[model samples]
Target: MKPEDNMNIIFVGKRHEASRVLSLNGTVAFVLAVFVAALLIATAWGGYSIAVSQVEAREPSESELVAEWKRKLDEQKEELAVLQQNVQYQVDALTLRLGEIQGRLLRLDALGQRFVESGLVASDEFDFNEPAAVGGPEDSLSADSFAAPDLTRMIDELERKMQDREQQLRLLDQVSSRQKLEDELYLEGRPITWGWLSSPYGYRSDPFTGKRTWHGGVDLAGKEGSDIISVAGGVVSYADERHGYGNLVEVDHGDGLVTRYAHCKTIKVSVGDVIQKGQVLALMGSTGRSTGPHVHFEVIRNGKSENPETYIKRASR
Candidate 1:
């Protein structure tokens, strides 16, 4: 027996035959129902997804977030502005205080300058900003240079000047004390008080004689028998005059100061009598060449007869 032909059942893709039409129809119907149901489900799912996407898209956008950020930025800007204003105010106040301090410093500097000019404070011997110099030759500053100096050196210079001023003040006090001592020993007068001026110096009419004459002294009018005091402490230069200045007494105060009193009712001092300032010299009266009771006063300096008024002011002061 020959090998039987292998029973082969091969199925290939083909369209449906008409002999099994019912079965074919039933399968087609089932497939169509399934396809329709799947289509319906797919369409429903796509529509739901599109609606959800639309809802999500309708929520707050980036523009709204950007607007919120802008508002926050504006608030921060306001806060920054407030802080800046506070800082500026503080700075301005500080600047004002600095200006006031500078003004006070300038005034103090001016006062220091005046003190130096008045010889109350001594000034620095050398410029602080200049280079060191010593002994013999004088050196000059360079015109083109701006100098930076040591603060320690300037402080040292100030201290030296302060010491010098302290020394000067001590010497000034000594001189003042010496002057007061000499003034106490000198003879003086009360020229302004106790009388009124009646006559001036130079040529004038003689009041008693009614004649034109040169007046050698000034007349101090006061009541007769008024106190006539010595002008200075000195020995009696001349108690009796030769003529003109009748009943006159002259006292020679040392150091070129002399005083004379004339026209006295009675002389209390003699030729050799030593007189002190404020001691009674005579009594005022119309004793010689006078119209009314008065005192004739004269001051001679350096052998020249000066006006008594000038010396009278000094003595009164």
Candidate 2:
């Protein structure tokens, strides 16, 4: 239909019909169409085969995938171990705290029991299981907030009180003992009491003298050989006859008190011998400067003479 389509060729070698003009346009177009169609079909089939082979060569299978999962499992296991260790630490901390609280409870219980014994507080007031009483905004806090080391402090207070009580008891015992000792001293240690003086020092009637006369000792009337007693606790100063006193006895009492027993029928104690109150010294007698048997007694304090009658009156009590 166009000028380009008019190009032609003749096939002359086969026969007279072949010697006709040949149309190249139609044959060429047809061959070109066939070549293009074949190239497109072959390219599409090759691309499809390449895509299928890539699919067949795809990544690992289930076994390898499971190995990877196991790796992740191991990591998680390690993480769990660390978490368990942390949990154990927390548990230890809580256990320690619980132990501390239990110790405080035991202490509180002991303190309560002791309080009941000492009559300081009631046992019911210190129950540990009950909620702590709140005295203020933060009174329910730890033990330090209320009663801490105050537990042992009460021991000191009680010790002081006990010492005071013991001291008072000792004082009472001492006073009672002193009173008893005083009674004994009054009864036994008195000089010249409840007894008559048979002789007095430095002048007295000699019963022989019938007339008033200067004498060295006064005669005292008593049954011959009666008991002659010491008036106080002391050592014997002399126990021998000298001049008018026959078988005389003398005692040196402390604090300058002295007594002489003259005309003793017999002497019982010697010099430097300790004697207690009411101890027998000799028998009563009137052996020296006497017309009849009698005893003589004398009391001199610090070399000053007092009436033996006065001393005898006091000793009677």
lDDT by residue (tens digit), candidate 1, 142-258: 455422234335545655665575566557656654554355335455432478889999898777776988777788988888888876677788876436566788887777877
Tens digits of lDDT, candidate 2, 1-317: 44245456566765555377766676575666689999999999999999999988999789989999999999999999999998778667656655765565565455445445443446577653467776756566566442323433544465566556556645655565555334333423323223454455555544565666544333466677778787666789998988977778988876787778787788889899988678888887766755666666667679976566555557433
Q: Each candidate: what lDDT?
A: 0.69, 0.66
Off by over 4 Å in 1: 1-181, 184-193, 209-212, 315-317
User: Which model scores highest in lDDT?
Assistant: 1
Alpha-carbon deviation at 260 in model 1, angstroms:
1.0
* Candidate with the greatest TM-score versus the true structure: 1
